[model samples]
Target: MDCNYIRGADLSHDSELNQKALAYHADPKPGKIAIRITKPFMTQSDLSLAYSPGVAAPCLEIRKNPDDVYRYTSKGNLVAVISNGTAVLGLGNLGALASKPVMEGKAILFKKFSDLDAYDIEVDETDIERFCDTVAAIAPTFGGINLEDIKAPECFEIERRLVERLDIPVMHDDQHGTAVISLAGIMNGCHITGRSMENLKVVIIGAGAAAISCARIYRFMGVKEIYMSDSKGLIHAGRNDLNPQKREFAASEGMTQKEAFENADVVVGLSAPGSFSLEEIALMAPNPIIFTLANPVPELFPEEVRAVRADAIIATGRSDYPNQVNNVLGFPFIFRGAMDVRAKTINMEMKVAASRALAALTQCEIPPYLEELYGTKLEFGKEYIIPKPFDKRLIVEVSASVAEAAVKSGVARIETFDLEAYRHTLAERLA
Candidate 1:
């Protein structure tokens, strides 16, 4: 049982797995997925109709009526994974070409799970107002606009203005996507821990776009006392050095983050690495729900926090760890629902409904395949507080909830579409 020998133990057993992994990621002769011809398998007539004089029929019709483009082209199923160079992951300001990889990854995920065709378009501007105008001008080319990895505050304004300008669903995926999944995890966490959202005192670290949006969404979901923190300290009511956005949440009476956490039922870390100190965690209310969602590294590790308080419901943003609150669980299904229903915008009600749907999905019995992935017997408990990304039911459930919300909110263009049939259609497309 020597720890030194552990690295060698059964390591080669994964040689096949490693080879398969390497095969899938094989040095990009640009990584495979090419578009080939589909349906009636391409005859001379098909070729002419798709490309030559025959194509002019649809072109002329579309030119007469621009809305006809949706009837003729792939734009109905196409989403543009758009971003500006200001914020690309934890690596900020990498420019348009540099952010293409993340956008391409989004495309692959869209195709893989939802069978929606998507592509990335990284614009070469940093100015928020200009970027907003640019996306608004080009909005017709896509069925949905997915703003990825853009920096906060600016991201907030850009998405707001674009959704206002465009008819299609415009979303800042980092903000709403992260919030949806986080809400899902928190919902399950609350149910398992026997805590209600109304009674919980939540402390969220990081006042970035995700933090702000999540805080607001948490408020919408019934949490009354939400204490958010940036690098300096607590975001309460009116602190002197606050930015316009931070001023809304600035501490009024000088209550520090520690004092805010003293009676907290949940501590959400959306800040930088190591922002959640052990001392800060020990001050939380009993059976606290802690979600350290900082990437690559969490604000605090699950094991480290559990050492301080064993009963805490701990989750992170990493798949290698248990209870991973991955944003992948939210966006694809969300867009799937929105696009299928031809929703005008991804509203807050839809977002909350999707979150509730996600939470509800986890409340059901765990799938057997999850045992290998989670490395634990999954059930309704602190350890199994959220569903894995591979859970197939998530797509249908969350999408239905979102679509229903869209209808209720009057954002949906298709008022009476069959959701069950649509879900089956997506399943067939993916199959």
Candidate 2:
């Protein structure tokens, strides 16, 4: 694949590319994923074992000890990519049926990137309590639940209740996936810019799920002062209409977006396109780290940022650009590790471990084949603040770190863990 052609391919007005994308989805198969039997079903004995008296033995074993389900069935390796379709990528609330493509795409990523089986499940309910109840009721079938594209306020509550109600690891990927991947970039960007987290003044635009989650995670990483804003303007202490989730990130006083950007050490954008101008980018402090990570488009294009402030280290959510803060780099492997150890939940320690693992991978020597494939040199600098999504080392490194953290944090059900053997197991699964 030619990098320039990929970067320059404009699908918005290109009828040919649009048709190709549609045909790619519609042809050969109706969807991007399908189920295949892992065990033999060709003989009479195979049928007996798969569906009849022989299967009853394992069922009885699972009844005697529920943990035996992991030993006798595929439940341990399966994940449910559940979504209410309230917030489908950059498209916004396209409804359950319309969100199928993105959900299926997510399932494909789980299989392709992490060698895990995922089923895309779109639940057609908007009421928060009903949604949470529905997911919790069905949670026992899978090792983990990946909540996707549920809208804010409700998403926060849904995730909280699900995490508390169910023992299996549950995560709202739209919220924490962006946070984890962006935090990795921030870690390396801060390193390159010679700034410490505690001293940095951060500005986050868009107080939706991703924005609020990023603010919280950055604070956990020792960032003290953070300014955030939504479409209604700055989230501040004086705002009477703020929800509890938004209130957690409210600034001291309401400030205009321009005021929020002034002298900031880092600025993160999760809002709409053209939300920030070059003038806003120029207002940041020297050697600023800017992550304008809106999909399809960003707050400010990389070219616009570079033309205004050459000293800034910029990233976006587009693969064509350098430092793409993609969630694909986080969730698949995060869940892989969580399921590998039968983790009770994805805790703060596991999340931080994954982030640090990603940051560390970026600093390692890039493989020559990866450079040739991506048509760029991969070194730790302004352009390479995080690992590429295609880097095969991700499943081995990030997943192992997360699994180790799960064990150390007392969240793993397994009594013993071998880190070296686990890495080889992860590699062989991909192979």
For lDDT, the strongest prediction is 2
Q: lDDT of all predictions, in order shown?
A: 0.80, 0.88
Cα lDDT tens digits for candidate 2, 295-394:
6667778888899999989999988789999999999999999999999999989999999999999999998979989997778999899899999999
Give the 10-residue window scoring lowest on summed lDDT in candidate 1. 1-10
Q: What's model 2's lDDT at 340?
A: 93
Cα lDDT tens digits, model 1, 291-318, are 9987655778788998999978889988
User: After superposing candidate 1, which stretches have Cα over 4 Å from the reference?
Assistant: 1-28, 31-34, 39-43, 64-66, 372-376
- Error in Å for residue 250 of model 2: 1.7
Clashes of 1: 5
- Angstrom error of the Cα, residue 120, model 2: value is 0.4
Model 2 alpha-carbon drift over 4 Å, by segment: 1-17
